[model samples]
Target: EPEVTQTPSHQVTQMGQEVILRCVPISNHLYFYWYRQILGQKVEFLVSFYNNEISEKSEIFDDQFSVERPDGSNFTLKIRSTKLEDSAMYFCASRDTGRGNTIYFGEGSWLTVV
Candidate 1:
């Protein structure tokens, strides 16, 4: 199975600051996504991107959050202004275009806001 990888496995940030989480999705996968798990909570979907455009987004992905496929290989999520509540484990995921394909998740980037 292909894999998704993320960088800065852990991060500490001041409240009201900016953060950028980087990811490298499987080369063959066409769809990429961002999800977050607040400690002890269920994984929540943030956004999905395909063909260089956003295909879907959840309410939690507000104006402060953004996703980008900067190049053929790198996918990124940016939090323009981090808040205390923003601290969570951010996961990058990807899947092939095939129907019913399994989505692969990265190890995740743990964000802690101070």
Candidate 2:
């Protein structure tokens, strides 16, 4: 079976710098999404991409954030300016064309901004 892979497992960046979180979701997945886990807050939705366009996104995904599928198999989230509050565990997920929505998460990429 195939699985998603993130380029960097952990990242530390300075505030005001840019950061790109990458992930290769399961090859057969038709829907892709990015979610985040704040230390003491609920899991939050960031954005969802399908058919090369954004299908849905939360208010959390502001102008500073963008998602793209650079290549057919890779999905990425770019943060224009990193902020300390942006530190969190970013998760990439996708699901195949099935009857039920069973999303699989990548080994989440951790981001730390100082």
Candidate 3:
């Protein structure tokens, strides 16, 4: 069964520092997205990437944040300057071609800011 794998399940970073969260979705889905859950809050969409370009993005995805598919295999989300507000569980997901609009969140990277 294909699944999404995220590196560094947990990460602690100092405020104003840089952090890079990596993920690999082992599927041939056309839509890839990054969603974050801040503590007890609901999961919020950050950005969506398709065809190697950003198809959609939320307000939280500012200039400080960026995502990339370095080699078309691994997807990386970089925070140029980490902020306290950025501390949350960031989930990297993609649409399951086997399923409809249902996305599989097999892996998520947690970020902590001090």
TM-score of each: 0.97, 0.94, 0.93
**Tens digits of lDDT, candidate 1, 34-104:** 99999999999999999999999999999999999888999999999999999999999999988899899
lDDT of 3 at 27: 62
| lDDT agreement of model 3 with the native | 0.89
Candidate 2 is scored at a TM of 0.94
Model 3, runs deviating above 4 Å: 96-99
lDDT tens digits by residue: candidate 3, 1-114: 888888889999999999999988766777788999999999999998888999999999999999999886788899999999999999998884444577877468889999
Clashes (candidate 3): 0
Q: Which residue pairs come into collision in candidate 2? A: none
Best by lDDT: 1
Question: Local distance difference test, per candidate?
Answer: 0.96, 0.92, 0.89
Candidate 3 global TM-score: 0.93
lDDT of 2 by residue, 1-114 (tens): 778788679999999999999999999898999999988889899998899999999999999999999998999999999989999999999988766979888988899999
TM-score of 1: 0.97
1 or 2, which is superior by lDDT?
Answer: 1
Every candidate's CA RMSD: 0.8, 1.1, 1.7
1 or 2, greater by TM-score: 1
